[model samples]
Every structure is written in structure tokens, then in C-alpha cells.
Target: MTAWDQVLELLGSPLMQRALLAAVLVGAAAPVVGTFLVQRRMALLGDGIGHVALTGVALGWLVGSWAGLVPQDTLALPGAVVAAVVGSIVIELVRERGRTSGDLALALMFYGGIAGGVLLIKLAGGTNANLISYLFGSISTVSTADLWWTAALAVLVLGVGVGLRTALFAVSHDEEFARASGLPVRLLSMLVATIAALTVTIAMRVVGLLLVSALMIVPVAIAQLFARSFNRTMTLASVIGVVVSVAGLVLTYWQDIPPGATIVVLAIGVYAVAATLQPVLRRPPPPQDPHPDMVDDVLLVDDVDDADGATVRRPSPTT
Candidate 1:
């Protein structure tokens, strides 16, 4: 068969459809929450959460064997979600309490989670090979059930991440100010961590646990180069995520490369290209400390903006 015929044949396959849908959902959802993470200077939060989620996967596997569950892989995602949520909360609590340093807490979480996962898997009569797929991703093996889980979780992530963007932004921008404004900063911080955990779980199937944070952060990094406003950066990052995801899947179909690795490489390539061109393509400076009334609309949120005017008045903590 000719190359075009092979391409058409591959496109017509059912597996490709499932893979594409899962990829798009994951791609679109990851950056939504990632935007807030980047803004909060917690870009690596996803990585830490992903590492912790490994324990959940093994827990599910071990329990599934004990409970006679028919499909073990199906349980792993939910388990990862649960583990990730707990890990996120623990990390936040540690950071909030001021006793343990944040990085130290994350380091402990990393070692404990990964080690626990491996031990659990081995105790369950599994081996390192069982984890290879979860660590590096096995998108091609994503089943129909996995797709449904991805879609539902993706929607939840997008809704929470984007629906509460303003409030989330306020908290991420400045916790003390947000708290003073009665915006329920603590709850919002937890919510951000929850959304980030969900992002890690969902992306696990698409990009694997080890590389998930790259998907969460790289697109935002790329958008930072040219985005003139906070909203634009999110939009650009999300679009880049979706584009690279779909493109990576298609490229892997023909190139026989690992989809997760390819997708991450493509995103990084885009970032590199954008960075190289950033100087010549320089945009206007981010709106400088917009009027108090205009903070949410144009304060230009980036890794860390010093705009003192940034604040949100609606959706008071009581609300």
C-alpha cells in the first residue's frame, strides 16, 4: 500500500479514534489547571502529585487482585486520583503549617509515593514491567472504559479550572490579599490542588506519571513568551496543548514512536521555537498594574506579576 493508503487506513481504525479523543480531552484539560499552577509558582506541583499517585495505582492493583476485580487497569486511574488528591492536600497542609519546608515535603512525598507504589506492586505479585506503562504511558493501550473516565474527569477539571478562573486567580496571585478580601483563600488553595491532582491523574494515561508535569507546564511556558494578558496566556497554552497532543498522536502513528514522549517533545520544540523567536516577536509589556476595577480583566498574570492592583471582588468567600 502507498503511504497515503496507510495513513487513511490508520485513521479509519477504531483504536485511533479512541486514542485521539482521549488525547484531545487530556490536552485541553491539563493546561487549564496548569495556568493557575504556573501563576502560583507551583509548576512542579503536578510532578509531585503524579509521583504520589503511583502509590494509588499500586494500591488499586493490589486490592483488585484481592477483591477479584475483573479489570485492574480500570481501577488504577481512580486510585491515582484519590492518592493524588490526598497528596495535594498533604502538600498544601505542610506548606500552610510552616513547620516543614515545601520542597522538603515534596521530596518526602516523592520518595514515599514511588517507593510505596513499587513495593505494593511487588507484594501483589507484579514487577517493574507492570509499571513501565504507567510511568511512560501506554496511550495505545487505553481502553474504552479509560476513555469514558478521561472524558468525565476532563470535564470536571476544565469546569473547575476555568469556571472559577477569577477566584482561582485571585488566590493564586496573592493568598494574603485574597484572604483579606474574604475570598476563602484556604478553600481556593485546596481546590487548586485538587484540580491539579485531577490533571495529573487524567494525564497519566496520556503522558504517563513521570512526564505529566511537562504537559502541564510547557505549554504555559510557551504562551508566556507572547501573551499580553492572563486570559490570553491560558488560551494560548490550552490551544498549544491540544495541538501538540493531536499532532503527536498522528506523528506517532506513522513514526512508531512513543506517543507520550513524542507529544512532550513536540511541546518542548514549540516552546523552543517560540523562545527563539520571542525577541523579534516581542509584544507590548503586560498591562502595568491596571486600575483596581480592571485587575481581573487585564492585570497580565504570569509566573509572578508584581501588580499590586490585582484583586477580585465578586464570589466573596461567603458566596
Candidate 2:
């Protein structure tokens, strides 16, 4: 079959349909929450949360194996989500304590999370393939249940993002000012962090732990290059994200490449193009005033003191 035929065939299949839908939902939701992260300069926060989520996945597998409560794979989702959310909240709490810089706290969490996840995975006897799937994603293996769960979480992310857009922008721009203005700055920050954690977990299914942050941040970066305002950035980033996600999935299907990596590569390509054109596309500086001080004066002139000690007011530079 030709490439287009294969694409059509795959689109007709239930598995491919689920994968595409999941990608769209992730594309739409990730950049929305991600815009706030980018604005707040917390771009790596998602990656850190993703690292912590690996431990949750391993723990879920172990608990499910021992307790027989659910399928190990099924349990991993909630486990990862819970772990990520808790990890994010802890990060916030640490930031509030004022003992460490936010970057330092995130870096510590990043290393600790990966270390804990590796240990848990080894203890759980998870196969290398299972570990790889979590790290890099296996979109072909995304089950129907996974699709619904991802969709639900995506909706929640979008809902929370839209409902609190103003508050989020206020806190993101200036927390001290927001606080002084009676905006629950701490509470909003925590809420945004928690929502970001959830976004990372959901995005992990489509882009994997290693590249989830790329999906969350790259689109926003690209949008910022061309967008004029925060809302415009969010909207344009969402569009860019969906385009890249769909294009990546289609290309992966055609070339038999890794979906997560392909998606990230596509996003990077978009960023590269945007970055390249940013300077060329920027608006030129407005024309300068010839006599900036002349606005308050009835007559515009440059005074010159001659040898006679008398002031001669000549017309300004423009004249």
C-alpha cells in the first residue's frame, strides 16, 4: 500500500483512532498549562515531575502485583499521577520555606525522583522493555481505558486553566504584587503547580517521561516568538502543538519511528523555524522624536550661546 493508503487504513483502526485522539487532547491541554509554566519560568518543572512519576509507575506495578487490586499497567497511571502531584506540592512547600532556590529544589527532586524510580523498577523486576516504554512511550500500546483516562484528565486541565486564567496570569507575572492585591498568591501558585503535575502525567502516555516537557514547553516557545500577548500565545501554542502532534504521529506511522521522539523532534523543528525567523519578523522600532523636549514648549528650538553672551534660539533638528 502507498503511504497515504496506510495512513487511511490506520486512521480507520480503533487503536490508531485512540492514539490520534489522545494526541490531540494532549496537544491542546499541555500547551495551555505550559504557557503558564513558560511565563513563570518553571519550564523544567514538568520534567522533574515526570521523573518522580516513574517511581509512582513502579510502585503501582508492585502494589497491583501484591494486592491483586488492578492490572499492573492500569494501576500505574493513578500511581504516577498521585506521585507527581505530591512531588510538585512538596516542591512548592520547599520553595515557601525559603531555604533553597527553586531551581536547586527542582534539581534535587529531579535526581532523587529518577534514583528512586530506578530502584523501584529494579526491585519490582520490571523488564527493560517496560522501563523503556515508560521512559520513551509506546503509543501503539495505549489501551482504550488509557485513552478515556487521558481524555478526562485533559478536560480537567483545560477547565482549570480557563477558569483561573486571570489569577494564574497575575500570580505568574508578579506574586508579591498579586499577594498585595489580595489575590491568594500562594494558593494560586500551588494550584498551577498541581495542574502542571497532572498535565505532565497525562502527557507522559503520549510523549513519554523523557520528552513530556518538550511537548509542554516547545510549543509555547514557538508561540512566544510570534504571539503578541499571553492569550494569543496560549491559543497559537495550542494550534502549533496539535499540528506537530498529528504530523508526528502520521510520520511515525509511515516511517516506523518512535512516536515520542518523533513528536519532540517535530516540535523542535517548529521552534527552530520560529527562532530563525523571529528577528526578521519582528516589528522595527518606532521613529524617534527629533525634539523630545519640545512637547511642552510653544516653540521648538535649540538654544546656542554666542560670543556676545546672548542666547539665539534656532529651530530644532527637524527644522
Candidate 3:
């Protein structure tokens, strides 16, 4: 059979289709959420959460072995999800409580989770190879179970994102003012924590916890190269993410490289090209007229609000 025929054969399989679908959704969703994290200067937050996700994977394995609730090496979705959420909350709370800087908190939580996970693995007597696969994902290992769980979490992330849009915007612009306005800042902060945790938990199975942050950051980072407005940035980020992931998966089949790493490397390449072209595309602002200032006599002031709640601005920015 020809190469095209082999590719078609793989695509025709239900399992392959499921894996592709999962990759597309995660590729889109991670960057969509990541834009917010990146804008808030919380980029390191994803890295921390991704590391903590390893603890969840380990705990899930331990739970499976101890309870005999699920077969060994089966999807441990629930255990991982729970552990990730708990760990994410712990990290955020540490920051909120003034116990440490966000970076320090993340490092502590991540290394602690890693240490704990290693101990658990040792206790379970699982082989090093098993841990290696969990640390770095194997595409062939992404089962139907993983796809379903990832799909469900993707939906949840989108839902929470939509519902929290206003609060997020407010908090992003001015946290102190948002709190003063009684916007439930603390609750919203926790919700953001939950969303970050959820993103990491679901992505771990596909990319492995070791590289989950790539899924979360790469697309958004690339999107930043092309978009100016926040909304446009997110939309473009999702599209870029989905396309890169699908392309990477296909390349993996051909080149025999790991799918997750391939996708990330492709994203970085795109970002680099965009970065190189950005300066050339951006035009310098037209020079201002050097004549007398036309608006020197204008004294701008905020007009009082009328009954209809419209502010009649006499002059602003024109002066």
C-alpha cells in the first residue's frame, strides 16, 4: 500500500479518530484559557499545576492498586482530577495568604508533589518504565477513556470561562477596585484556580504531566504574535492550537517522534516566524503636525451624568 493509503487506514479507525478529536479540543482549549493566565502574569501557574498533576497520576495508580476498583494501567480519571484540584487550590491559597510569592509557592508545590508521587510509585513497586510513560506521554497509549474524560473537562473549562468573563476582566484590570466593588474577588480567584487545575488534569493524559504546560502556553504564546485585541487573540490562539496539534499528530505518524513534543516544537517555530515578521508589518505612526496646537484653548472635563445615564463628554483626548 502507498503512504497515503496507510494514513487513510489509520484515520479510518475509531480509536484514531477519538484520539484526534481529543487532541483538537485540548489544543484549542488550553490556549484559550492560557491567554488569561498569560495576561495576568500567571504564566508560571500552569507549570506548577502541570507538575502537581503528576501527583494525581501517581495517586490514581495507587488508588487503583489499593482499591482494585479499576484495572491496572486503566484510566484513573477521577483520582487524578481530585488530586489536581486539591493541589491547585493549595498553591493559590498559599499565595493568597501572603505566605509566599506566586513563583515560590509554585516551585514548592510542584517539587513537593513530584517527591510525593515518586514515593508513591516506589511504594506501589511499579517499574521505572511505567513511570516514564506517565511522565512523557505515548500517543498510542491515549485510549478512548482518556478521550472522553478530556472532552468532558474541555467543556467544563469553556463553560466556566464564559460564565466568569466579566469578573475576570474586572479583576484583570484592577483587582483592588474589583474587590472594593464587592465582586466576590476571592471566590472568583478560587474559581480561576479550579479552572487552571482542571486544564492541567485533563491535558496530562494526552501530553503527560511533564509537558502539560506546553499545551497550556504554546498556543497562546503564538497567538500573542498575531493578535492585538484580547478577543481576537483568544480566537486566533484556539485556531492556531488546533491546526498545530493536528499537524503534529500527523507528523508523528510519519516521523515517529512523540506527538506532544512535535506539536510544541511546531508551535514554537510558528511563534518565531511571527515574531520575526511583526516588526516589518507594524508601521510607524504618522508624524504629528508641527503647527500651533489646535486644542490649546480646550479644557476637557467629565460632563455630569444625565437622567438616562449617558455622560456627555465636552472634550477628551482631542486636546
Candidate 4:
């Protein structure tokens, strides 16, 4: 079959449809929150949260096995969300109250999360394959329910992100200035952290616990190379994410490669291309006049004599 015929056949499968929809939603949502994270220089936080989320996935599998209340796969996402949120809150609290630096706190959490996840997965009787799936993503296993939940998450992330765009921008760019302007800097920080955790959780379905940060950061980095404004960066990053996700999925379908790794590789490739061309693509500044004073003189305009009987006005620059 031709490439188009293969793509058409893949699209006809309901399972493929669900996987593609999940990928699209995740692709669209991750980079929106990610741009803010990238601006704040908190990109590694996604990786930390992804590690914590593994513990949550293990816990969900354990609970489901013990209670027989639901399928293990069905419970994993919620478990990951809850764990990730709690982990974010803990990180924030540590950064606020603990004497240790934020980097130290994140490092401690990252290691602890990975260790805890491994122990929990063992206790849950999860096989290495199960662990690998969560670590590297198993797009073929994404269900219809996963698709719906991912869609809802995409809506939430986009809505909250757009609604608070100005505040997020202000806080991200200059926290002290934003606080001086009476913006609740602390609250907004917490909100961004929480949203980032959620974004990581949603992206895990497509990129897995180990590489979710790639989805959240690579596109934003690429966007920054080409975009001069924050809004444009966000838009371009999101578009790049969607394109990579779809392309990755198609490649996986045709080549039997791991979907998560394929997606990340594609994103990194784009970033490489953007980085290579950035200097060429970037516009040069307009040349300044050698005789600035003469140019200023040309801009100056004489003011009309004031109401005072004496003419006191002097030439002043028009601009």
C-alpha cells in the first residue's frame, strides 16, 4: 500500500482515532503552560512532577488490585494527577519555608519520587513492562476514556492560561514588579505550579513519565528562537507541539517505534533546525544615524511665546 493508503487505514481504526485525539489534546495543552514554565525557568519542574506521578500510577494500580473497584489502567491517570499536585504543593512549600535552595529541594524530590515509585511498583506486583509503559508512554494502550479526560484537561489548561495571561506574564517576567503592582505574586506562583503539574500529568499519556518535560519544553524553546513576543511564542510553540505529536504518531504507526521517544526526537529536531537558522532569521536592528545631535536638531520645534509678555520659550525636541 502507498503511504496515503496506510494513513487512511490507520485513521479508520477506532483505537488509532482515540490515540490520535489524545495526542492532539496533549500536544495543544502542554505547550501553553509550558511557555510560562519556560519563561519562569522552571522547565525541570515537569520532570520532577513526572517522577512523582510514577508513584501515583503505582499506587493506583495497587489500590485497584486490592479493591477490584476499577481497572488499573483506568485509575492510573487520576492517581498520577493527585500525586503530581501534592508534589507540586510540597515543592512550593519547601521553596517558601525551608532553608534549602529551590534547586536542592527539587533535586531531593526528584530522587525520592523515583525511589518511591520503584518500591511502590514492586509492592503492587507491576511488571517491568508496566513500569516501562508509564516511563516511556504506550500510545497504543490509550483508551477512549483517556481521550475524553485529556480533552477536558486541555480545555482547563487553555481556559485558565488565557484568562490569566496578563497576570501570568507580569509575574513570570518580573515578580517584584508584579508584586509592587499589587498582584498576588505568591498565589499566582502556586497556580502556575499547579497548572504545570496538571500539564505534566496529561502529557504523560503520550510522552510518558520520564520524557513529559520534553513535550513541555522543547517546543517552547524552538518558539523562542523565532518569536519576538510572548503571545507569538506561545502560539508557535503550541502549533509545533501539535505538528510533532501527529507526525510522531504517524511515524510510530508505520515504523513500530516507541511513540513517546519518536515525538521527543521530532521536537528536538525542530529545535535544532530553529536554533541553526535563528541568527539568519532574526531581523537586524535599524542603523542609527552617525550624527545623532543633528537628527535631534531636526526633530526640535520652537514653541510659541507664552502668555507672559516676554518670549521665554526655547526650542524643544518634538518627540
Candidate 5:
């Protein structure tokens, strides 16, 4: 069969359909929250939440094994979601209460989260291999239930992140001013963290926990190469996120590579290319009409008519 034929056959399958849908949902959703996180100088926040969510995965497995509830992995979704949200809130609270020690707190929390996840999963009778899937994602294994959960969570994240763009922007840009202006700065801050947590979980199935921050940050960086305004940057980043994600997924099918890694690598590649070409792609300022006052301390000769009908104002280059 031809390569296109094989590609068509692959896309026709139920598994590919679901994977594509999930990838699209995650790709579109991640940057919505990421934009806010980037603005808040919390780019690594998604990675921390992802680490904490691993513990939730283990909790779900433990509960399922004990209660004969859905398969050990079935509850991983809700478990991860709850864990991420709680972890995000905890970090936000810590940063608020321990301003001088915030970096120490985040580092402690980050390492603790990873260690907790590993230990908890081991106790649940799972091995390193099981966590590997969550760590790096197993896109091929995203079930129908995961699809529904991803869709619901992605919608919630996109809705909240975009709907409250103005408020979030205000909070991210100037917290003290926002509070003085009657915006709930504290609540908004926590909400940003919560939204980032949700985004981390939402991407878990497609990009894995470890590499989630790349998807959240790199796209914004790529967009910022050209975008001058915050809203434009977010919108363009969302578009770049989806394009790179979907393109990476398609490449996985074509090349038989790891989806999460492929997605992230593609994002980085695009960024590299964009960064290289940014200077070339940038438009030079439009030539302005030269006026005498455009230069400071220039003694102008009144409109001197040269040979041509044009009047010329001579400029002194000296400051």
C-alpha cells in the first residue's frame, strides 16, 4: 500500500481518532492556562503539579486494588486532578505565607512530590514501568473514559482562562494595584495556580508529567517572538500549541516514535527556527517624514527649495 493509504488507514481507526481528539484538546487547553502562568512567572508550576499528580495516580491505584472498584488505573484521572489542585494551592499558600522562603518551599515541594509518587506507587504494587507511562505518557493507551475526562477538564480550563483574561491579566501584571482596585488578588492568584494544575492533569495523558512544562511555556515563547501584546501572545500561543501538538501526533504515526517526546521536540524545533528567523522576519520601522524638530537642537533653515519642487529641512546629527 502507498504511504498515504497507510496514513488514511491509520486515521480511520478508533484509536487514532481518540488520540487525535485528546491531543487536540490538550494542545488547545494547555496554553490558555500557560499564558497566565508565564505572566505570573510560574512557568515551572505545571511541572510541579504534574509531579504531585503522580501521587494521586498511585492513590487511585491503591483504592481500586482494595475496593475492587474500576481497574487500578481507572480512577487515576480524578486522583491526579485532585492531587494537582491541592498541590497547586499548597504551593500558592506557601509562597504567600513564606515570601522569603518561597524558592526553598517550591524546591522542597517539587522533590517531595516526585519521591512521594514513587514510594506511593511502589506500595500500591505497581512498578517503575507503570509510572513511566504517566511520567512520559502512553498516548496509545488513552481510553474512552480518559477522552471524556480530558474534554471536560480542557473545556473548563479554556473557559476560565480565556473568560477571565482581563482579570487574570490584571492580577498577573500588578497584584498590589489589582487589590487596590478591588480585584480579589489572592483569589485570582490561587485560581491561576488551580487552572495551571488542571492544565497539567489534562495534558498528562498526551504529553506526560515530566515534559508538561515545555508545552505550557515553549509555545508562549514562540508566540512572543512576534507578538507584542499579551492577548495576542496568548491567542497565537494557543494556535501554535495546537498546531505543534497535532503535527507531532501525526508524525508519531508516520515515524513510529514517542508521541510526548515528539510533540515537545517539534515545539522546540519550531522555537529554534522562529528564534533564528525572528530578526529577519521582523519588519523594519516605516520611514517617517523627516522634519526639523524630529532631531533635537537642530537649527532649521526655513523651507529651502532645492532644484526639485520639494522643500528640505536640514537636520543636525549632533545631540
Candidate 6:
């Protein structure tokens, strides 16, 4: 096939359609919440929650494979959501009780959960079929059910995200001040955690748990270098994500590289280029401070007048 035909053929494939849809939807939801996640210095929270999704995927596999309650392919999501919620609550509890930082607590939780998942996999005789998918995502393995789940999750996440935009803004900027201003900062934090967890779960199906967090964070990180407002950040991040997703899929199809890894590499490339170009594309400065101390002598001189009413002020000299 010619190169153009090959590209067109891949786009027409059912698996490609499903994979692109999942990537686009998850990409949209991820960076929207990620804007806040990055600002709050909780980028690792995405990693932690992505790890938490592994527990869900394992449990889902176990239940479907062993208990026959749900199909094997369907196991990953429920387990991910439950584990994510638990991880969020645990992070909060650890902060309140142990006085530990959220990062420390999340690190502990992620390692502990991974250890537990390994033990569980060993106990189940370590089937390579289900385990490999968690390590490296398979776009071909994504089912219609998984696509529907992702779409539903995307809608729910975006709804909460849009409705509580202000509360999230407040919490991201200043938790104490948000609470003082009568915003439900604690509740909003939970809401944000829940959304993050949900997005992590859905995105895992597209990118796998190991690299899914990168999809959530890297795109937004790149967009922030150029985006002037919160809205612009989300838009640019989504656009970058979509472009990378499509390009990654094409590269994966041609080179037989893992799609998830290709996606992350493309995202990193975008960030690297943006970072390099940021110096040349400086944003307009924020509004200047109103205080007189901040005003330059030249500017202050412009504000003053000489006895003759000229704008320029004469400097005093001493003999």
C-alpha cells in the first residue's frame, strides 16, 4: 500500500476508531482537571491514582476470571474507581492523622498497593494475558464496553469540573482562603480527588496505568508555556493531546511500538519544544502592583510636574 493509503486504512479500522475515540475523550477530561492538578503541585497524585487503578484492574480480572460476575475485559474499571476513592481517602486521612505530606502518603500507598497487587497476581498463578495489559495498554484489546465506560466517565467528569470550576479555582489557589471565603474547600478537594481518580481509571484503558499519568500531566505542562488563561490552557492541552494521540497511533501502527509509550514520547516532545520556545513567546506581564514602591523613578517622574508644569522633573544637585 502507498503511504497515504496505509494511513487512510488505519483510520478506517474499527480498532483504530475505538482507540482514537478513547484517547480523545480521555485526553479532554485529563487536561481539564490536570490544569488544577499541576497548579496544586499534585502531579504525582495522577501517578498515585494511576497506580491505584492497577489494583482495580487486577481485582476486576480476578472477579471476572474467577467469580464470573462480570466478563474479564470489564474487570479493570470498577476496581480502579474503588481503589482510587480509597487512595484519596487514605491520603487525606494520613495527612490529618500522621501529619505527613500528601506526596509521602501517596508514595507509600502506591508502593504498598503494587506490592499487594503482585502478591494477588502470584496467588492467582500469574497469568500473563491479563497482567501484560496493565503493564502495556492494548488498543486492540479495548472492547465496546470499555469505550462506553470511557464516554460515560468523560461526561460525568466534565460535568463536575464545569459546575465546580470556581470552587476548584479557589481550592487550587488557596485552600485556607477558600474556606474562609465560605467555599467548601474540603468537599471540593474530595470532589477534585474523585474526578482525578475517575479520569485516571478511564484513561488507564487507553494508556495503561504505568504511562497514563503522563497523558494527564505532560500535555497540560506543555500547554501552560503558551496558554494565557485557564480556558486557553485547557484548550491547548486538549489540542496537543489529540494531535499526539493521532500521531502516536500512526507511529504505533507503522513501527509496531507500544501505543501508550509512543503517546507519552510524543507528549514529552511537545513539552520540550514548547519549553524551548517559551522565551521567544513571552506572555504579557500581569497587572503591575498599585503600590508606589513598585513604580520606577522614570515612571514616577512622568507622574510628577515641575514648577513650570512640565512633565519632566529636574534632579536636585548639591554644591
Q: For model 6, how does the per-residue alpha-carbon lDDT over 196-314 read when each residue is reduced to its tens digit?
A: 88888887767777887788889899988887887788778877877887788778776978888888888998889889988888866666554536534444654466768666654
Q: Higher TM-score: candidate 1 or 2?
A: 2
lDDT of 1 by residue, 1-319 (tens): 9999988898799999889999999999898888998998888889999999999999888888787787665577778989999999999898888834988999998899899999999987778799889999989998898888889999999999889999998898888889889998889899999989998998998899999999999999999888988889999999999999999999988788999999999999999999999998885767654444543443333434446765533342322
On the 0 to 100 scale, the lDDT of residue 290 in model 1 is 41
Positional deviation of residue 296's Cα in model 3 after best superposition, in angstroms: 5.5
Model 3: per-residue Cα lDDT over 1-319, one tens digit each: 9988998987997767876888888887888778778767787787787777667777778877876755664535676678778877887677778744777888887798788777876666566566766667666677777777888889989777766767776776677899899998877777877888888877775577788777777778877776888778878888988898888887876687888778878888988888898888888766765454454454344444456777555543435
Considering summed lDDT, which 10 consecutive residues are worst modelled in model 5?
A: 295-304
Clashing pairs in 4: none
lDDT of 5 at 287: 69
Mark the regions of model 1 whose C-alpha exceeds 4 Å error after superposition: 1-7, 283-319
Candidate 5, 165-274: lDDT as tens digits: 99999999988899899988899999999989998998998999999989999999999899999999999999999999999998888788999999999999999999
Q: For this target, which candidate reaches the highest TM-score against the unseen true structure?
A: 2
Ranking by TM-score: 2, 5, 4, 1, 3, 6
Cα misplacement distance, residue 222 of candidate 3 (Å): 1.9
**What C-alpha lDDT does candidate 3 achieve relative to the native structure?**
0.76
lDDT of 1 at 246: 96
Measured over all alpha carbons after superposition, the RMSD of each candidate to the real structure, in angstroms, is 11.7, 2.8, 8.4, 6.3, 4.8, 5.0
Which residue pairs in model 1 clash with each other? none
Better of 1 and 5 by lDDT: 1
C-alpha displacement of 230 in model 6, angstroms?
2.3
TM-score per model over all chains: 0.86, 0.91, 0.85, 0.87, 0.89, 0.85
Runs of candidate 3 with Cα error greater than 4 angstroms are: 1-7, 288-319
CA lDDT scores, all candidates in order: 0.88, 0.86, 0.76, 0.85, 0.87, 0.77
**Candidate 3 similarity to native, TM-score:** 0.85
Check candidate 6 and list the clashing pairs: 56-79, 56-80, 60-75
